[model samples]
Target: MTQRFLRVAIALVCLTATTAWNDASSAVAETTLGIGDKAPALDIEHYIHEDNGFGKVEKFEDGKVYIVEFWATWCGPCIQSMPHLVELQNKYRGEGVQIVSISDEDLETVQELMEQEYPGKEETFAEVTNAYTLTVDPDGSTTEDYMRAAGRNGIPASFLVGKTGLIEWIGHPMELDEPLADVLADRWDREAYKEQMKRQEQFQIAMQKVNQLAGSGKFEDALKVVKKVLEDMEGADDPRSNLIREQLTAFQYNLRLDSGDRSEEVMTFFRDQLAEAKKDARELTQFSYNMMASMQQGTDLGPLAGETIAALKDAVGTADEEVMPIMYVLIAQMNASMSNFDEAIANQKKAVETSTGRTKERMEQMLEQFEKMAAEEADGDQDAEGDKAAEKVDAAK
Candidate 1:
């Protein structure tokens, strides 16, 4: 644990109120499916978008590539990926490619979503999704065969079937371009890809154990689970392996800090992250928030955050407009903690400008408090000066 790592500095899953991974990903109990295997039958109950001319696939139709995506109306990631799926359908529909999105909800739930207007568009959800095949299965029969059988519980999981009725790829829909192109051109190395997905699925299972241990307050044991995986994957340089390794390495610090004991190693890790992420606003914001939150909890991070306050503030310069307001509030709060009321007030004003609605009102209120504190400090300084002058006059007399 003391040795240096790649220091990839992945984002930490936050544990503010308590140091635990609050995972929202859906999970299945068992997996009987794998890449390079035959895709399950398209046991659909109803095609919601059938009336829009987007038909269905009764089974894995031979020679036509299919992207079977599992999603739900309530899953945010699922909803966000809808536009990308539509784009893929447009690009490949004429090329013998079909995109079928399945939801495990009832017809009524999916129909309700169709009635709502699309974001930033006048069309309804049904209209926006008319380009792709949208279906709902109340019985969850298709989900059992695809999602459950694959040991997948996450929404927006896309299963790509190659021309031979075999499942070629399974992953997020947004990342489908490269692999889908490969499958279309017959350039896919199914054997190698299958191994990669297999390893990743195993990694996900290990992560569940790690999360359990961390949530149970057994931080050391939780770290051990990650360490074992890292050790097993020591020489693997594949993107998925590297990403998982990096994520696990960064995740160690969270477990360590939350274990009611702190180490120099953990402190050094964040200190290095603060220094490395100084130029990347999003990364800097995340790192700063993680450190600052711990600081508020009285975790003695050895002034790691205090000493690097200037660099954290520097992120504000490079931050995106949406992120700029958060930087202002973070800086303002840190300044207020050190009793720099004027600086805090300035930042609060910036926050008020960048934000709207309730956020703006809250920032305005914080600005007032800082102004009041600054005025009181100014009056106290003037009284001190007056007393000092009176003492000088008495001495002269």
Candidate 2:
């Protein structure tokens, strides 16, 4: 496995272990609810709002579509999407569509938050959220029935329940409009959605296996799974396919680098990939960064350093304004590693000038360090010259 991939996998494993779910695999397996499946019933403990008035709703009525959204007041994205949800509710109210915003917080917490004043706004939380139906999941019955049953581990999740009580779609609330329009117009394609979900499920299963093998230091085995995924996704226009291909290439490159006999082959591969990446500024920047990172990790690039530097310079010539600064920093590091301190300091100074925020601050710090190293080298050279002159004078005497 590539270093980046391994780091990401480790982080994901740690997160999954600490989550409320038993394990990552179980969490993946539990997502059994899919399109065409009958949606679970709404079992809310308390209804906070009902169509401009306060009341309760026990069940979803027939011939009416419902948007069951799970959200919390503290979730920034959830709060940001509230007004959009309100707008959607208003737009579809005449079509018998109701948006039910469910929060798992206790009734007391919800009430207090609603009454509390918000920062930079005259309206309280309750005033802003009064347009849609709000409810508290005091016993988590609605959550268990809807969110858990669908194997959803994150909030801001939404499900569109068709008039027939079947789930037509599931995704983030922000992406609800397109599918909602389809469902209301009686043109939603269940079969296509099922196929799409099946592909995603298969992809998740493959990644889980790859993660397991990689986490155990069995990269050779993990490589096989990665290649299989790439093959399975070949010729597809899916973004995931491209991501998997990149991972596969990185893993292969690292494995070859570790092999003592494959030096020539790996160097050739690097040259070819770098040439291809140079066509795009962003791609070249990423390529240069990865190469520099590998060098920092003690990988001996030897003659490839010169080649990489040349390619980076070419990339910089055509790079975008925002990307040029990052490329310059990498180039500076490459030059410094090659003992070309003058060029390093110059490029780093340029980086400091072009960058902003924390990046500019960091580049300024690196420039200072490079300058110090140059000064030390110069002082050492002068000391050596003085010693030689003294030795010559003593010999002449």
TM-score of each: 0.66, 0.54
- Model 2 residue 137 CA deviation in Å: 0.9
Q: After best superposition, candidate 1 residue 12: deviation in angstroms?
A: 19
**Backbone clashes counted, model 2:** 0
CA-only RMSD, every prediction? 9.8, 10.5
* Pairs of colliding residues, candidate 2: none
The residue-by-residue lDDT of candidate 2 on 1-397, one tens digit each, is 2233323322322221111111123336476577889888778888776558434556767888999999875554565567778889888978989888899998998887788654335787787778778889978888888878877766678889998989998777887898899999999887777666666657667768866775565667777886887788777664435544675677667644533224677788888888888888767766776666555544567777778888888778667555677678778777766557899889888887875443455667677777876777788889999999999999999
Among these predicted structures, which one has the highest lDDT? 1
Looking at model 2, which ten-residue stretch has the lowest summed lDDT? Answer: 15-24
**Which regions in candidate 1 have their CA more than 4 angstroms from the true location?**
1-28, 51-53, 261-268, 271-397
Per-residue C-alpha lDDT of model 1 across residues 57-162, encoded as one tens digit per residue: 8877788999999887655457657788889999988889989999989899899888877544678888889999999988999999988898776566889999
